[model samples]
Target chain A: MQNKITIKNLNAWFGAKQVLHDIDIGIEKNGITAIIGPSGCGKSTFIRCLNRMHEVVPYAKASGKVLVDDRDIYDSDIDPVEIRRRIGMVFQKPNPFPTMSIRDNVVAGLKLGGLKDKKILDTMTEESLKKAALWDEVKNDLNKSGVSLSGGQQQRLCIARALAVEPEVILFDEPCSALDPISTSKIEDLMLELKEKYTIVIVTHNMQQAARVSDHTAFFLYGKLIEFGETDQIFKKPKEKSTEDYIIGRFG
Target chain B: MDRLKLSFFRSSRSKLSGDFIFEAVVGLFALGILILAFLLFRELFIESGLSRKTFGLSFLFTSTWDPVNEIFGALPFIFGTLVSSFLALLIAVPFSLGIAIYLSELAPEKLRTPLSFIIELLAAIPSVIIGLWGIFILAPFIRDYLAPPLSTYLGFLPLFQGPMYGLSMLTGGVILAIMVIPITSSVSREVIMTVPTHQREAALALGATGWETTRIAVLPYSRSGIFGAVILGFGRAIGETMAVTMVIGNSPRISESLFSPSYTMASVIANEFVEATSKLYVSSLIEIGFLLLVISVIINVAARILVWKLLKVEGGKVA
Candidate 1:
């Protein structure tokens, strides 16, 4: 598979403490790649670096190369806003714009980009919600406040919102960690369907989730990439002892 | 062991009684506020009975104030109070929102604390000292520098016409705007800060610029709160006495021009309360006080309802 994203010698810091050491990983196009690690292992920080979101925190900094489509996103001339548009993110907790209606929340990104044509917005909202598996549930209540939905529905609504912008890549930073098992299974199914058309990267601490949904898996420990291989290989025959220990529930 | 258990039971019983006493004391203090408000209203209503009976509803519209003849009307003072408070809001709202946005979103870490401290300090300065500064500094500044250009360019409008006086409604409004800014901005800053980090990230991840993120995410989330802050400023402006009385010229007349001297209800009360000799004259002044109190209560209730409605419609969930 062709690599959609290439990272080289990436490092990140929050104030004085470095969280991500020199890292290199290539994300394949049209496939789900999972980054698995214990808490505080910099898994979330690593994915945030992909879309330049790590730097949104005060005093947080990142250095190195993040290239999409063979062009460096970190180039001095590149706009971070433009990069972010091409690389969308869905956070761990669902955050639908509280003040907006279901229809408005779905089209928020398009409206922000000055797309005011009503017909197009309506069509896009429907299509994105359908893709997120939320259209059937929320179609009748399109005008309701975004937060009026159940937690699982809210997460799906957030996914639809991310999809509205039609980004080339979508990042999920432990998107289902706050969800129930049924919701988690639904999101896992959605990721499988989504990978057919978009590059997908997920950061999760759930090793079983990684084993179940990912085509490729990277295991991180103490800010280091301990192992990376095919999902079957990583689970069945990890090359590194630390990866084996972690996979077998020896120690996180 | 039996003695120890008995003591424990006794202590527990005493603690329950203490809790009840504490609750009753707090409840009484809360009730005291309502009682005090009612008493104030009763006193104003009874004392202003003569004016209310003599002039009836026409008193609010008639614009004549003659102490010697015992004739009075609240029109000019009402007009002046409303106009000056609204004008203060017009000038202060933009600057306050700008200051709040900068402090909450754009200010560097090192600058945020000191800038916030300075704004709070501005709010703490005595109104009497502000009145003195208004007389010496703000009045002259408006007369010499601000009013000339406004009348010269926008002179066709009645608001900017007439000769510029150092002491006028314009000066009063400007002084009120200065006094209102710190409170409005600080409250707005706090409201803006309450917007969760995830909301901003949602906007940013959608390819929005910093300004766009604030416009879409931060401002909308804090709309009701900012409105409440504006209302708070209006409350302060309407009731402000010392600074406004010193700069408003204390004239009992209405004119189209902001450059003309005018009187506000609070200013008139502060200026004439002690000197009011006739029973009718004092009653009329007290009636104006009654009107001011009623207007303030109405405004506060309306603002609370509006904020509450906005929050309810949005489900009151930031996450």
Candidate 2:
């Protein structure tokens, strides 16, 4: 499989405390890669580094090579804004822009980038919302505030917002953690559909979710990657003792 | 066992009585404020009864201020108060928002605390000292450097048409602006800071630049709050007496020129109340005081509503 993103010896720190140890992983193009780990295992930080978002926190720093499409994203000349545009992220909690209407929230990424053509914005909004499985539900209430929706709908709205920019890769930082089981299942199905076009990376604590939807799985523990392999192999015939123990609900 | 149960019941009853006393005491204090407000209004109303009866509604429309003849009108003072306060708002709003945005969004982490402290210090300075500064420094500066260029370039407008006297409406407006900036900016900074991190991150993830994120996410989210701050500033400006009185030239004449001398209601009352020997003269000044009080109450109520709306929206408890 062709790798869309390559990380080599990535290290991250928040103030004096280092969180992500030396790590190496590759995300495959047009595939969903699930990173499963216990709380505070640095799974979220790893993906944040891929899009140069780790440096946004005050006193937080990272040292690594994150190569996207064979170019180092952390190169001094590269713009983090542009890097972020190409790599979208949906947070654990659904955070649709509260001030914006449903339609405006979807087109916010494009509109804020100075896209003035209303026809294009309208088309893109419809297309992106349709892709996120939210168009039919929100089409009539395009003028309603984004936060007026249910938690699950709001997450889908955020996904639609991310897709509005037409990013090449999408990152999910526990996107379904705050959602109900039905919403979780819906998101998982949507991810399966989305992987056909965009590279997908998910950080999830739900092992069953990782086993159910991911083609490839990476198990992380104590700021280190313990195993990376096909989901079937990792679940059925695990090579690492720690991975097996974690998969079978042993000590996290 | 019976004794232990009786002791427990006695303690619980005492606690309930303590709670009732606490509620009644606090409730009385809250009602005390309302009663005090009512008493103040009644006093002003009774004290100004002579002027209310003599001038009736025409007092609002007429511009005459003949203390020698004891014939007073509120128009000039009303105009001065509104124009100067609005001018102060026009000057302060931009600076306040800029300061707030810079402090909350753009300033370095190390600078935030010191800058905030300095702004609060500005607020803490007494209005009389600011009035003194207006007399010594601000008025002369406006007369020499600021007024000449403004009149020469924008003189075609009526507001900039007159001679540049140092102590004039423009100076009063500038003084009020200086006095109001600290409160407006600090409140705005607080409102902007309340914008959640997730909102900013959401904008950043959408490829928004720093300014774009602030414009799209921060400003809109805090719109009502910033407006409430501005209104609060306006309330302060309209009621400002010392600094404005020192620089406003205290003339009871209306003019189209901002450079012309003016008198605000609060300033006029402060200047003339103690000196007035006649009952009617004192009553007229008290009438102006009553007007000022009414205007301030209206503005404060509006500000409270806007701020309350902001809280409701943020709390997500009301539609």
Candidate 3:
């Protein structure tokens, strides 16, 4: 399989404290790779580093090379705005702009990309919603305020919003931790289907979810990657003691 | 066989009485404000009865202010107050927004604290002291430098046609604009800062530029609060007395020129109230005071309603 993203010697810091230790990994194109770790294990920080979002936080810095399709994303000439466009992100909370309507929320990224044709926006809105598996329920109420939706629907809307931008890779930072079981399954199914077309990196606290949805699983502990392998191999016969211990419910 | 249960009135007698007394006391506190307002209006109306009877509604529309003949009208003061306050808002809004944006979004963390402290210090300077500075520093600067160049180029416009006087409506407005910046900027900064981090992230994640992110997310979220701040500033501006009196030249006439001397309601009352020799003159001044109070009350009520509706329309929850 061809790799879409390659990382080498990634180190991140929050002021004086280094949160992400030296790490190296490659993510395959058109597949789901899950990053599983306990809290404060730098899973979020690692994904944030891919889009240069970690550096946006005051006093936070990173020294690393993140390559998207053989082009180093961390190069001085590369703009973070362009990098973020190529790699979209979904936050943990279902944070739809409260002032915007459902239709407006879905097309927000497109508008930011400077797409203003009403007909195109209308078509894309429906298509993105369908891709996110939310069109059937929300098609009739497109004008409703985004915040008025249920939590599950809001998450789906955010997914649709991310899809509208047509990013090559999408990052999920615990996208379903706040969702119900039904909603979680729906998103999981959606992600599985999306992996056929777009590369996805999911940071999940749920180990079972990582095993169920991801083609590959990477285990992170104390800002270090302990093991990266096929999903079944990582879950069933992890090579590292820490990885096996984590998978089997030992100390996180 | 049926047993009768206690009626709500009889069963909850102690609770009902307790609620009644509690509500009455709370209602009395509410009624106290209403009574005080009513008393204030009644006294002002009675004290200004001479002007009201003699001039009727023409008192507002007429421009005459002859203390000797006791022919008093409030049009000049009203016009001056409206124009000066409007001009102040025009000058202050842009500068205030800039300060707010810089402090909340762009300023370095180390610089933000001291700069915010400086703005608070601006607010604490007494109005009389500001007036003193206006007379000594601001008026001369305007007369010597600003007015001549502005009049030379823009003299075709009636607003810039009149001869320059050191003390004029423009001087008062510029000083008022300075005084208002502190309140407007501080409130706007707080409002912008209250927008949730996720909102900013959401916009940035869409590949929007920093300015675009602020425009789409931060600004729309805090618009109502900013509007409330502007309204508060406007209210403060109209009610300002000593500083405006010092710089506005105490001229009681309708004038289009920024450089022309003019008067406002509060300034007029402050200038003439203590010096009035006749009952009619004093009554006219009280009428002016009543008019000022009424205008302020209307503004406050309108602002409250507008802000409430704005909050409903925007529906932005600050996290």
Which candidate has the top score in TM-score?
2
Summarize candidate 1's per-residue lDDT along B1-319 as a digit string, tens digits: 5323423223343555655566557878988999999999999999999999999998999999998888899999999999999999999999999999999999999999999999989989899999999999999999999999999999999999999889999999999999999989998898888788989999999899999999989999989888988998898899889999999888989999999999999999998999999999999999999999998888777666655554454333843
**lDDT string, candidate 2, A1-252, tens digits:** 899999998999999999999999999999999999888899998888888888888888999889999999989999999999999999988888888999999999998788989899999989999999999998999999998899999999999999999999999999999999999999999999999999999999999999998989999998899999999999999999999999999977
Off by over 4 Å in 3: B1-46, B298-319
- Which regions of candidate 1 are displaced past 4 Å? B1-38, B301-319
Chain A only: list TM-scores of all candidates.
0.99, 0.99, 0.99
Scored against the true structure, residue A229 in model 3 reaches a CA lDDT of 90
lDDT per residue for candidate 2 within B1-319, as digits (tens), equals: 5323523224344555655566557878988999999999999999999999999998899899998998989999999999999999999999999999999999999999899989979988999999999999999999999999999999999989878779999999999999899999998998888888888899999999999999988898989889999999999999999989999999999999999999999999999988998999999999999999999999989987887777666532124
TM-score of chain B of 1: 0.90
Backbone clash count, each prediction separately = 0, 0, 0
Name every residue pair that clashes in candidate 2: none
- Cα RMSD of all models vs. native, in order, equals 3.9, 3.6, 5.3
- For residues B1-319, what per-residue lDDT tens digits would candidate 3 score against the true structure? 1113323333444554665566657878988999999999989989999988889999999999999888899999999998999999999999999999999999998999899989979989899999999999999999999999999998899998778878999999998899889988987887788777888888888787889888888888778778877887788789989888899898999888999999999998988988999998999889998998998888767766655655455323432
lDDT of each: 0.91, 0.92, 0.89
List the candidate 2 regions with Cα displacement exceeding 4 Å: B1-32, B315-319
TM-score, one value per model? 0.92, 0.94, 0.89
Shift of residue B181 alpha carbon in model 3, Å = 0.6
